[model samples]
Target: MSVSEQFVGGDGVISTPIATGVGTGEKAEVIGHRTADAKPSGEYASILADTPLQADEAGVASRGMYSPLTSLCNEPRFATMRRGHKVMVGQNGWLERPGSIAKKPEQPKKAGFFDSLKRIAKEVADATEMKSSRRVKGGERGRASSRVRISLDPREQSLLYCELEFLLTSALDCYINSQFNAGRLDADKYKKVVDAWHQKGRPKVVGFRYDLETQLDLVFLHMKDFRFYGDRASVPAAISGILEAMRVNARALRVRTFCQPDSVMAKQLLDSQSLLNLLGSAEQRQIQLAEVVQFFKIVLEREHKLQRTEEVRGLPQ
Candidate 1:
């Protein structure tokens, strides 16, 4: 049975891969579609091919919702390959025109390829329960049978990135909420920051579709002006607040990563099993919290140094 059929509890159901919207200069061709009714309960399935798939009335109307093969690309927002550069889908529209601004030259377009494969492998693992696939003998055993590789299309990759962005935003909100609940952050500050985030901060990040380090920079920028209490003693409280925030966030992220459906962030977290599993034990949680604090400290100090250097350069050089 194909992995997808396993998802919907279907077996021995031969699914023909269908193509849709072929040779349409404005649209993308897609592959891998099982029959509409072939998919069992509470799941959506569609296939895209070089040519459009002829589906029943209900399927025909819904086909455009998921696939880039026809209507998805009809919206200018869907990421498309242009001059070999992949575009990013924006929350409301296209983040960038493919060649408008060159992205970091060194960064690769298909960076999430392996991550998608790993996510599918993890999905298979969870579906079959890897423990059952294991053969514990003498000293060594065979690898688990619950492993598979998947090559994601550019459209799929864009969707995964969008989902991951949403998850990160959710995690950040949880962290902020934890601090607010602990009384470490002022109510006014919390409201203002969150409002600004939803109104401006998040939209900006989503627009850029930043990398991890750039995202961290954005976080620091947002938090730099944050004020809880204007007192020297409050400095320590501020740090502690953020430390607690990160601790809570890390644990929440761990739970979310394991329980949520397969995605890019989940795959990244699973790859770093130590970090993902840290919250399972008290000692590990403590260790992870300390590392998070140290990392925050390093970033803060680096930013301070850069500011100082810039000031000095502005004055003399």
Candidate 2:
């Protein structure tokens, strides 16, 4: 029978098994010696060869034949390995330990001054374009050339004119009371009167209405003392202002009546126009208290006539 055993050499080489046999009826002989000139082949080359080991102490101590299985610690690729420390495989296939690899520092990206300005300019341009587009659309809708003529009958036109005149009178009275008598007009009633006049169809009356309302607001603000001032200038100024507004209203009414030549309101419109013209001429020559009184008297008489007509016709006041 032959016995053989395999072993790995100290230089990290694997050796083949060597076999020895005993002849029949003969004692087994030990063959521990081989010729010095012998060179090994195949798996037993490093084990049986007579080559001398290299005289490198560090190389001989570091090399292991069964490093993957028998070695308890792995050699580090970049740093010294300490006892009881955990080892890890790095991204580059190197053995790494704790705190061995340094992290790359991060840098922030900086923007140039011109680049910031360009971004702000672009935002402003976008906003301006949007605003311009909105303005164009608004202009197209509200252009005066797009206005159409509105038609109304004689009675309806007269009623609308009378209502506007009444609203203007009420606003003036309210202003006078507040400024002279320290009276407070009922805000709700004032707003209702203005709103009612606004609901009527009188496109031409809008300008004078706004003028009256603006003057009343100035009076409420106590912009001037109309009762007495230098040479009674404030009173004349106030009268002239009211007379100018009335003239404007009367002119708009005349135009409306002229459009409908057959309307019965034409007669009333003519009379009102003549009175407004007279007042305007008087105001141009420096308004007097007598002329102001006469103006009020004429307005009161027209209002009284309208009330009488409405009552005679069984119409609501």
* TM-score quality measure for candidate 2: 0.19
Q: What is the alpha-carbon lDDT of model 1 when measured against the actual structure?
A: 0.33
Q: Give the per-residue lDDT digits (tens) of candidate 2, residues 1-317.
A: 11111123333332222322312222222222333332222212112122222212222244432211112112232123347644358655357557767785687687664344334334433433332232222456555432322233354345445444443443343333322222222223333444445477423221112444443443333333323222223455554554455545545654645333222222333333333332222221121222222222233234445555886998854
Give every collision pair in model 2.
none
Model 1 TM-score is 0.22
lDDT of 2 at 95: 79
Taking all chains together, each candidate's TM-score versus the true structure is 0.22, 0.19
RMSD of 1: 28.1
Query: lDDT scores for all predictions?
Result: 0.33, 0.34
Looking at model 1, report the run of 10 residues with the lowest lDDT sum: 1-10
Return the lDDT, model 2, position 186. 26
